[model samples]
Target chain A: MIGFETLLRWLDLAGIAVFAASGALVASRKQLDLVGFMLIAAVTGFGGGTVRDLLMGRTPVFWLRDPALLAVASAVGVLVFFTAHRIENRFRALLWADAVGLALYAVLGAEIALVGGVAPWAAVLLGVATATFGGVLRDVVCNEIPLLLRKEVYALAALAGAAAFVLLRMHGIWRDTALLAGMALCLAIRAAAIARGWSLPAYAARRD
Target chain B: MIGFETLLRWLDLAGIAVFAASGALVASRKQLDLVGFMLIAAVTGFGGGTVRDLLMGRTPVFWLRDPALLAVASAVGVLVFFTAHRIENRFRALLWADAVGLALYAVLGAEIALVGGVAPWAAVLLGVATATFGGVLRDVVCNEIPLLLRKEVYALAALAGAAAFVLLRMHGIWRDTALLAGMALCLAIRAAAIARGWSLPAYAARRD
Candidate 1:
């Protein structure tokens, strides 16, 4: 039987790969060269977890502890940058990849936060932050409005998923089962939002 | 003699206040209201130290542990936001305030890193991060280029200060004396750079 830790680690790596690919696509869109692509990919892949770990006081960040992940992210960036010309609709591609990463990250993040002794509510926030902040950092670096600041369904999905996991744990559910349920919810909501072009409400500035 | 820890804490709070003031000025320029002013000010003042602490595995975060510093930063934000119109040459004012924050943070940050058992080089990087990351986050949120990314003498001053502090400490100098020397060097370099408009070299994209 695979240990829970091993299983979660694998899923986390998958999340990182998908996020890195999406970041590379963004770099291509911005017309940045090799350096930009690698930088963005690394930031997106490790950024959310880095922020989460820092906040949780987990020393020697994941990437810094295991630099192989960074090398993997860099490889993905190079791959995407070189093959971007063959891809049609980079934004669409990024969204699809990002959705997968979000689902995986939502579960992994909440689990880590809970294990680290954070309260449920803050864990949910950390889960959402862990799922979204990488893309946010990528956007900021590329000089675009961060998706977190936009009225998007992205952060909402992560929040709902994280909450679901925490709620299940509160009800004595097994950790692995709860995580799987959370991932499903995240993926479902994100997929629906993408398909239906869903968005959260925005507050317009008053002219009066 | 005041305990070294107490003196350092006081200096750190002073740094936060000055950085917060600069952040409020930037918020005013961006036409952000009260919430934005406070948010920016808090981030600009504490962001660097928070990141440094997080990286060093100093959990609960400095501001989160002791909300008093945040209160102080918010107070500065409130004061600046209310009196922004009355201030002449806000940018000039921000520059000076930021310079003071930079010097103080340079000393405090390196000291914390050394105390935290981090390697000397990493501690220096942490010091530079502590001195500059707040401003970097402020620029990102405000949709401006980060000061660190530009060819500025700012980060360089912090780096130099941090290195000097570490070097002096390694040579068996008194901690308080080393910190003072480091702060002075950071202030003098930053002031000169500001007065002469000195900058590092920019890597412009080649126009082939």
Candidate 2:
């Protein structure tokens, strides 16, 4: 049987692939050059975790330490560039992949922050950071408003998942179980919101 | 004589003004709406330190706790929008104002990190965070490559100043003297770099 550490590593790799694929998909839609595609992929794959780790004073960021992550992201970018037209229902695929990536990142972020000795509230914030920052960076690079800031349930879903994770952990749930439960909760919430076209009310006041 | 705490608060406020102005200038260049302008100004003014504090597990982000910072940044945005056409030699003015903001932020970041019991290297990293993140965020919002990533002496100048500040503090230098000396060094370096058109080498390979 594989060790828990090995399973976590695999999840990390899967998360990177999903994020890179989403970024490349976006870039392809924009008709960006190969360099631009790769740039977006890399940023979307690593930007959030990099920011979170830097803030936490973690050194030699994860991708820097594990060069394979870069190689995988780059390969995925290339693949997407050539196969862009082959993917059916691009929007649906992108949304699903993004949801998976968000869930993985949120759980990983919460775990890392908890191990880093951060307070529970801070851990939740870090989880949101992991789930949302990659998309924010991708949107910024593509010159659009971040999806998180839109009248959507994106970040709110992540926050709910994180809070659930913390509460479960407090009640003596096993770590892996808590993480999986949190990720599932986030994925479910995100999927439902997308399916129902659910959205939060815009913060701006309505004009007369 | 002004009290030390009062002086620090004033410096922080001044830094906010300069950073917000720079952000507003970028927004004007992009022809963004008033809401966009305010968003850029607020992010540029407080994004770096907010990330830093969040990572350090500090509560109630700086601007959240002190609403005046938001007021100052908003005022600067409005002022820039109204007077943008009348402003002359904008590039030069922006360069100088940016340098002042960078120096002030670097000093403040280093001080805050030191108080938080971080290592010197981490403190220096936070200094760079304070000085450069606003510009990075602004560029991202404006859909441009961040000035910091373009390999200017920008981050280098901040790092140098941070090192100087930490060194002086280690030798028991008075806080005021150390702060002044460090800020002066960063401002001078950034100004010189701009005047000389200095930049880091591009990532692209050179053709023979």
Clashes of each: 0, 0
Error of 1 at B166 (Å): 2.5
Backbone clash pairs for candidate 1 read none
Q: What fraction of correct interface contacts does each candidate retain?
A: 0.22, 0.10
Question: How much is A186 displaced in model 2, in angstroms?
Answer: 1.1
* DockQ per model, Cα: 0.14, 0.10
- Candidate 1 residues lying further than 4 Å off, grouped into runs, are A1-45, A51-57, A63-135, A145-208, B3-10, B88-90
Q: What docking grade applies to model 1?
A: incorrect
Which docking category, incorrect, acceptable, medium or high, applies to candidate 2?
incorrect
TM-score of each: 0.61, 0.61
Q: How far off is each candidate at the interface, as Cα RMSD in Å?
A: 6.1, 8.6
Q: What are the per-candidate TM-scores when only chain A is compared?
A: 0.92, 0.92
TM-score of chain A of 2: 0.92
